[model samples]
Target chain A: MTLSKRIIPCLDVTDGRVVKGINFIDLQDAGDPVEIAKNYNEQGADEITFLDITASSDNRDLILDIIESVAKQIFIPLTVGGGVRSVNDVRRLLNAGADKVSINTSAILNPELVKESSARFGSQCIVVAIDAKRVDDHWEVFTHGGRNKTGLDALEWAKKMVDYGAGELLLTSMDRDGTKSGFDLELTQQISDAVEVPIIASGGVGNLKHLVDGVKLGKADAVLAASIFHFGEFSIKDAKEFMKNNNVEVRL
Target chain B: MIAIVDYGMGNLKSVHNAFKFIAPAIDSVVTSDPKVINNADRVVFPGQGAMPDCIREIEERNLKDAIIHAAQSKPFLGICIGLQLLFEKSDEGNIEGLKILKGNVCRFVSSKTEKIKIPHMGWNSVAHHGNHPLWANISNHEKFYFVHSYYVKEANSEIVQGQTEYGQKFTSAVAKDNLFACQFHPEKSGSAGLQLLKNFTSWTC
Candidate 1:
């Protein structure tokens, strides 16, 4: 009974504001990162992950201020990702009060970065984020915010990440990013089977049923969503209740 | 005041936050000092990550003696790896544990047909076993967040507060007089978790 289903709400921060949408388009400012995090905390979100999607791409100082603000205000665990390329970046983020640092593009480019950072900071602090999009009828890993295809199979990359010492896998389906259809069950199961660490299924979470399905069918340890949570499509309390009703274990 | 023993393993901030959320008036401090732990109203030992490192930290910081002393005096709560450390020993890294709970921690022996995964990581229902103040608000069959591979075995069954079945029934919560533990992250367990913390805060030992 050591396994627990995590309900994570992702905050896509750009220029210090929480922005979210499907396929990352027509983004609307949800609110201050700290404020929204507080709301999520009250709503019983198991954890909150802040994805600084624009920070590194724009070559700006990673929004330590926002992270610092949210860390100070929110009580739940905070995991920050995006543009974390080096061990130094990982150190900086952890020092900024992040409970965990998620590496995506950088880990794909340099798989050794995952091992190095995990060894230095311990694997529990390292989260390897895999952004996968269905290509040529196969799930292929993508990088650079889903703009660059690495031609690596999603399952193979996930196994490599675990070998490199990633404590957790944040698997996001790029094709389902904003679709609200549901999580890619096949992709989720593939990665979950490939790795021993906790797998957090992300993308295509439209409703509470989808979350239950992600955990039961996908065998995901946790479910991460962006647009649904950001736009107030469903509340964390409601989602947990729904999960419990469906016999999907959740913290009530 | 609740003394949260800090042995440099994982995040104590989330645990501190959870205590603050449930019992805002109950002061919580992360300290390695034996004197502070001895003087606190309650004690909480929360941990994450490997058992070997955590055990080394407890010894290095001289927290091992302090925690054992505090547990003898007041109600003590151990979360996740903290609970595993309460056992006599663990299969993880073949490390020695505090032996406070009169049990041993063993890895989940994955059956070939079951194909069950290790590091059981997710929410699972807890079946309450006995009367314990820490589980006042927590109902039977209520789910608690868990993330670990090894668990306590061969413990005094009377002290078992809750049990959960993954592949087989395992102790998810344990209580021995003033010493209490849960192999789940209550701070990360959401509202019900907060309520459990609140119950612990209000418990009169």
Candidate 2:
């Protein structure tokens, strides 16, 4: 009855389209977010996360449209985030077809939002995403998309988020993000061990081996990757098979 | 008609969408009306949020009798909070459950025997008690999407149909006569999820 490790594909959606603003591919055109999510689901992604990285005022409608379209086409669970500030925002996204909503900057600003939303929608549907960077032998929490340091230690913040009623933690290493070097194993394990909640190791997934290491070494309950799956470096099926072979206990 | 009891929690659309996707002509409905829910030949109860809130909605909507009646008479399915409500009481909010079955809902504890996380959120394997139609075609290793802090602990073990493990082995699914319930979210559990819902459509008491 062991729970299988999960592999999640993260999409940085902006202005109603998948943001390929990274150097991986020149997706100058508005890549259909729903279509990309569908492809990931078919490729055996355990779950798909749509991070609303857009700062547009009309971004809510676009994100809702994406959730509706993908929820109908794909059968897996969908998590949406970005610009979610209040409990109403969580309801809006959940009603729009999201199984869970990840709150980062907004949660840091008003910690009560996590408690309110969790009490209203259940902690299972609330995820607290933390963007952390190693600083002077310790990790510092970042906000506003990893720009402003909040002076809150990542380990302490992780515990606080859990105490505040967060169901899961999506920990992203700012330095490893986009570099594809690999996730910060020591940091991930530190947080995973610190809090009993599930840890989703995001950023720094450079290769197939990184996915396996996420569970084996970092002890993350789930591994979230972006450029690798988005750019077709390797499919979710490939990663799951690799984990299954490495005795990481993944659903194949 | 299939009535997905809308006691004002969880996602009814996901269940409706899954049924509609599987059998486009399936006459499935999400209704809070006690008469409609009780009259349906097949009923599915899917719920999320807090147990006390869910129970409040059920009582406020006059659905307590309807849900209990349907569970006894019709082919019923309960999910997540819907499943927990079948027990006697929950440690969450100190609320009394429907008490349709004999058991108690306890919070996941990290004890000396075994340390586990609360809200066991993720995919986990479910081992069925015996051959059951609800699990038809779903393999033993097939993982289902789950997100809950509490679970059925000291259930009438005789009725516990399926069990899963996080830090310790616990019941995940239960069935007796016409009632079938699980802690995992089939609507969010990918292919195996759709398959289970499809099986429910064809299952008979």
Candidate 3:
């Protein structure tokens, strides 16, 4: 009767290959993006997200080609993020079979893109990604793979994106990312309470309990993890089962 | 042959690919051409985005009459906004719909104490009614992917094939004669979705 909480597997891709980063550095190649995505789909991932970390315009077409092939096979919601700069990028990614397009740096650079794209495409397909890091008392938004500081309060940025017609927010803690120290509960809880739209907790999911904590403690509608699932440390079913055991409603 | 009526609003690739995956031998194409939709043995009216814009595109493309005609005569299938367009009107933009079915689309209302989000996104189970051909292989209460802000209301209870609950219980599926429609995206709902498309491929009624 009620909506089920989502468990999304994020594939960080660079130059058409899937790669994982530790603290946004120390890039490690996992495998082919297409093959890896298919594996996750088979493992019953609620949705698949492809973060194109490739900083070059030349490889944009490569990600599109990869998306095309995967879209032909996988039958789940696919979200594409990173390097999305304009409305044209949103259209291209959607045309290539992305169910949703997540905007990060471009959203911070030009908030109007969120309004314009959501107006034309509808808010359901536009996801605003806010990369945040702890700065003294509050979390500040970061851009360019968590490299540059925007000096915008993370909670304020999240509210602004929703006002700009973003249907969802992908909140990642730069501090907990890759450390697997579990999600920053305070950060996730604060932003989730502020926004009416669904929030996906990202960055520091190290185990199944961390995933459960993201839902129970953080109040996120969904949780995203990499490396652990990518490297076969645990199956997606294991995570869902664990969450279900802990009273979280998940599609099994 | 199946013609997925793409009025240029939502993702048509998933629908086209789902049909191709389930029954490759059948011919399925995403077309905006009214003639193609009218000629196809099965018609799929799939849409997303806002209802007013969807209505605008349908009118702009000159597909309103052709779609209404096909819905009356063929094994028609409508998904998401496609389902909404079949109603008489929608609260979104206060625009009128195709009026094939007698009802209006209303937005999900949440009071201060409710706190339910708008666009009820994500997966939820559908409680189907009776025995419709579309529910052949799909079990009752099977989960399906849904993303929408408005739902059909004031619809004839006789035509309601499935219902789902979010903030309130709403009609999620309907079947009138040969026309079958659902508010969920079976194309993106994994195996259950594929099976629904497969059933539609062979669905005669």
Most accurate candidate by lDDT: 3
| Overall local distance difference test of candidate 1 | 0.81
Best by DockQ: 3
Residue A49's lDDT within candidate 1 is 92
In model 1, the Cα lDDT at residue B184 comes to: 80
Superposition TM-score, candidate 3 onto the true structure: 0.96
Off by over 4 Å in 2: A21-30
Error of 1 at A60 (Å): 6.9
Stretches of model 3 off by over 4 angstroms after superposition: A21-30
Q: After superposition, how far is residue B106 of candidate 2 from its true place, in Å?
A: 1.1
> For candidate 1, lDDT tens digit of each residue in B101-140?
7889998876777656656765678888876887787777
The DockQ for candidate 3, computed on C-alphas, is 0.81
What C-alpha lDDT does candidate 2 achieve relative to the native structure? Answer: 0.87
Interface-residue RMSD per candidate?
3.4, 1.4, 0.9
lDDT of 2 by residue, B1-205 (tens): 8998997786688888888888788799989999998789899999988888998999999998999999999889999988999999999899999998889998888889865666688788888788889899998767898888899989888898888977889999999899999999999888899889899999988
Worst 10 residues of 1 chain B by lDDT: B114-123
Question: Which digits, one per residue and each the tens of the lDDT, describe model 2 over residues A1-252?
Answer: 487889998888888888762333333433888667766777788898998878768656789988888888788889998899888889989987898899999888999999999888888888999999999999999976578999999999999999988989999999898888999999999999899889999989999899888888998999999888777678789988888889888877
The TM-score values for the models, in the order shown, are 0.86, 0.95, 0.96
